[model samples]
Target: MRTLDSLILDQISGGADAGSLTTADTILVCDDPTGDLTAAACGSGRRVVVLDSDYSRCQRAISLGAQIAGDRRLDEFLAGSNGSAVAVGEMPKSLSRLDYLARSIAGAGFDTVTCVFGANNKHLARSMNETLATSFEEVSASRGRGKFRCLVATGPRNVTYEPAAGDGLVAVGGVFSGARADHGGELLRSALPAQLGRFLDLGCGNGSVSRGLDGDITATDSDADAVLSARAIGLSTTWDDAGSRFPAGTFDTIALNPPFHAGTTVDATLVSSLLDASARLLAPGGCLYLVHNSHLRYRPEVERRLGSVEQVARNQRYTVLRATAR
Candidate 1:
């Protein structure tokens, strides 16, 4: 039931020093889906470099004017420890990335270490606290802010980050992790058929729909962070869609709410590929179900491939499309 504004309000607030942020060069260590923070920061006149695990997030970051921070490798970023403060709207998953970042910082040096993890990232916080307690200067946590948490670790000190601002942006529950499923889940549940043999939710952000499906289903996205985030909640079987590779005609049903924006602009490539992939993945007589903004030009592409496409339903802002595999 949360609108975009409501979710954004409940999840993200003003970052630190909106003005004081040195316009100097900065590198953001984040996954692809969350790389928007790097782009936004870069727009503030800072020479930004983005380090991501997935190539897509890196490409999007550079497209937004962020310099390539040395390909999307965790070790690459962690090895040098630019010591410059990094920023994110939310935290990445627990893995060598956190450990590497901490080690790099300890070696390279930094003044302030500010981490904004999604409120839903308790496991991530726990992991960092358990593994890097002595490495960071200070470590602090806050709650109920959805998928965003602001942690400030000062010279090996553990301190909890306080709420920056409250306009209902801060949720009641402390930091929580999972896909931001509030609105997308409802849309998928409403648009999809009740009975399906096999399902594939493309760009399955947090696996919101795949998790709800009754039978066999596969969830996928180009964003590893999204796939990782969804899988952390038990929705597995994600593939990197960068190369657009998948077993042909392997799915009986496919669904998506496809992302509209990657970095800062409307990306038609993602939509175009989703359609092509749907056509390639669906078996004969299989169905492709999708929801997208009403204004996007998806009909022509759908018809081009499927030879038949129809609008199942529509509202002022969104449209649901259905097509059968030939």
Candidate 2:
């Protein structure tokens, strides 16, 4: 178990000992990437349900002896729990995601519910408590242990989800750029050719890069939240990792704004793997438009994987490169 997971379990056990959490209540483990909490909760002879957006994580939870709610949406799961569910998980890094989670839990028609979310101290913020307070009547922080602490929220208040309006981009929380155009995505979009055939928006976050584009466009992302956001805006989307599900030479044009971070850790290999995937997926003589931070220096990698590379656009923060498959 991760250190943060241990801390969260300690907090949950403390709550149960204090009579706030009962075994009769179903424990909803939300987005537990490690599956430790889900397994532990099930082992304690408690009714446990897992609420995770990622299909892979849900499978892990199931293997750990936890039941999954249909569709994996928090609201639907809590509604069936009959007001006797307590949620536990690691707090999301995105404040918008945290707020969305708190609201969904609070609005499940439950008169009362408790949520325990833990994370490293560096990841936790005062705004998290404020965000939870918007949905729950009470929000408090636990004492720090091993550089980790859990946020506790109780007394669910009546709240409803209000989708953000304007900008035509409909993104759920945790999706990159969140209902707005990311600067890197905008750069790649502008660099795209006016005419495209069999276009693929690789790593499409919220489908922003494919918006307003002509021809047969398909968007794909590894993150379930991102796929949901992209589909919300009427784009054809697939939840895939690095275009791995598609056959080679499937796309004539590919647009990529690959993610550089995997949960607070900057991993340059993610970009490299995406570059390789894009190269393999592009048809011979097809073009790829990729945007990244100016400092990543990906031109050589693109040239080695694809063919000749050209700088299409560049600003202080980002560089857009175009490479045609050989």
List TM-scores for all candidates, in order.
0.53, 0.88
Per-residue lDDT tens digits for candidate 1, residues 1-326, read 22222222232334535553442245444543545466556656655656554546666776787765432223334444444554443443543445544444454444454443343443454666654565565566654445544444445332222221232122111112232454544565578888877788877755566664678877777654455545555665454672255688888888877777654468866678778788888889998887877888888888888866888867777788889889
lDDT of each: 0.56, 0.81
Predicted structure 1: lDDT: 0.56
Could you tell me the lDDT of residue 152 within candidate 2?
Answer: 96
Instruction: Single out the weakest 10-residue window by summed lDDT for candidate 2.
Output: 15-24
| CA-only RMSD, every prediction | 11.9, 2.9
TM-score of 2: 0.88
Question: Mind giving the per-residue lDDT tens digits that candidate 2 earns over 1-326?
Answer: 89888887777676465533354367878768788888888787778887666656776777878887523345554653464667889998888778767887788875457899998888888999999999999999998887889999998888876544349898676777889998888888888998889999998888888987778989888776787778888898887567788999999999999998879888778788788899889999999999999998788889899879999899999999999999
- The reply for model 1, stretches above 4 Å from the true place, is 1-51, 55-179, 182-185, 242-245
